[model samples]
Target: MAEGGQIDTDILSDEAFDVLCSMCKNQGKNTEGEQYCVDCKDYFCVSCVKVHSKVPLCAGHKVLDKSQIKSRTSKGLPRAPTERCDRHSHKHIDMYCQKHDTVGCSTCMAVDHRLCKDTFYIPEFIQNNTYQVVATREIQTKLKALDTILAEKADRFKQDKQRLLKRKAEILADIRKFRQEINDHLDKLEKSSINEIEDKVKSLEDKIKDSLKQLQANKSRITSINDKLTSTNTNQSEVFVYVKMAEDAATVAYKYIDDSELQCTTEDIEYQPDITIPTQLEEKKTLGTLAKKHTKTSVSLFQI
Candidate 1:
């Protein structure tokens, strides 16, 4: 009876190991795992190893003996046969939620799939032979499709990144070009304004110099007339003529001075900048509006 119990335990262990072995599980075969493939991260029975060795894809795979597996296990490495939940690392995945079309742990079932209508214990679900056939076909098909989608998405992402980088460079170039255009325009305007100011100053200076020359000439004439009037040898008629000439010269000088004062009035030049340019620039948030265009393309994978 004790030997029979031992036999039964070994059979159960073999069955459990087969469940964890990719080769045995997929082939729907019952086999006791004897070796571990390091590269594949899977256990293989003697028969499975023979099959694995025959496959060209398994050429470089490294296999370890039971002793090595035991040694690794002793060093805290988990022995293959138990599939752990990705979300709950401490818990094993043993339940399936059909509604969500996902396999998860007991904790996942309790926390996430509690309200799901079609949840099942995986071990019990797998007892139905139809489940294996359907799962194998559908899962394999979906996995292949997902792989294709992933590859396409990766390519698209690369293309998009390149396109965006190119667009960014173009935008920066355009902005710099626009700024250069503005600088060029401002430089031209500055040169023109400076020339205008210089012309105005030159004109004003010329008028003041001309007025000064005239005033000086009038002063000289008046001085000469006064000197003639003071002469002792001059007669009364001559003196009266000299005095009249002096009065007329003084009147002309005063009138010229009054006229010159109006013409040579000291005034400063001032510049008023247009407030709108800077005010609008400060209020502006962006150079231009960024817009998104939606385009749709349909893809058919594994149509047949």
Candidate 2:
């Protein structure tokens, strides 16, 4: 209904004044409407009212006839479902059952809740329920606290997520760095081992060269003796040959280097990388729950 729009007449209070017809061309404020469409929750002119009964969805809507409505200036607004029973729409809830903690009409009392207690008045209950009053008042503060606590917890949850991610990245970086260190250590060990083997080979080569040189000198000495004997017509002293024999049994027992001592072997080296994170930390998906608690305010207002 548009503002400043009055009822149709003094006697007959038409419901058409509360809301303006949406289908009408009158966007002006004063629409002295005639009929009320409950489904659309709007007021309509006589002409537009007929369209509501003919339309598909609007046809099923319960409309309050013009005769049932009155103006605010008359008897004020009528008592709505507050006095009426939710279960029995036509009857008012006049009785209360203490045992079942519910309200009902006369028919409901007789048929279902037969053995109920005294008729507990709702107004008295609302006034005297001190626990409900105190709790509701306290819940106002608690409701505000929920928002503040949840905000703080949410910030902490984000911080924890950030920290967890940073720590995870750090652990992974450490693993990579450790791997690089192992590679460098292995490179050093390999270089040292190869240098050792090269030194041993050089020493063996020098010894073999010395042995070959001595053998060559011995051959030269034997050749010189043979020449001298031939020149003397096989008349050279026998002592000379004896002296050659005594020359250190060098030729006969040429002290050979033991090759068996240079057997192949491997160095002692190994790698171990182990880490552990708490199973609880790994399994948990969220930190905790953040929810508004049920309290007297919610239960009273929403009938929870």
Winning candidate number (lDDT): 1
Candidate 2 per-residue lDDT over residues 174-287, each given as its tens digit? 444543543233334334333543343344445434544544454444444334333432211222222222232223322311221132111111122322212233432222
Model 1, 1-304: lDDT tens digits are 0010011121122212222466777788766678887546687887788788788877645565554443222222222213455677755455556675566666777788667766654433443213323333343343334334334443543443344334444444444444444434344434444454445445544644565466557656655555554452223223323333455555676676567546432322222333343335444433333322222222211010
lDDT for model 2: 0.39
Local distance difference test scores for all models: 0.46, 0.39
TM-score of 2: 0.30
- List residue ranges in candidate 1 displaced over 4 A: 1-81, 96-103, 106-121, 128-130, 182-304
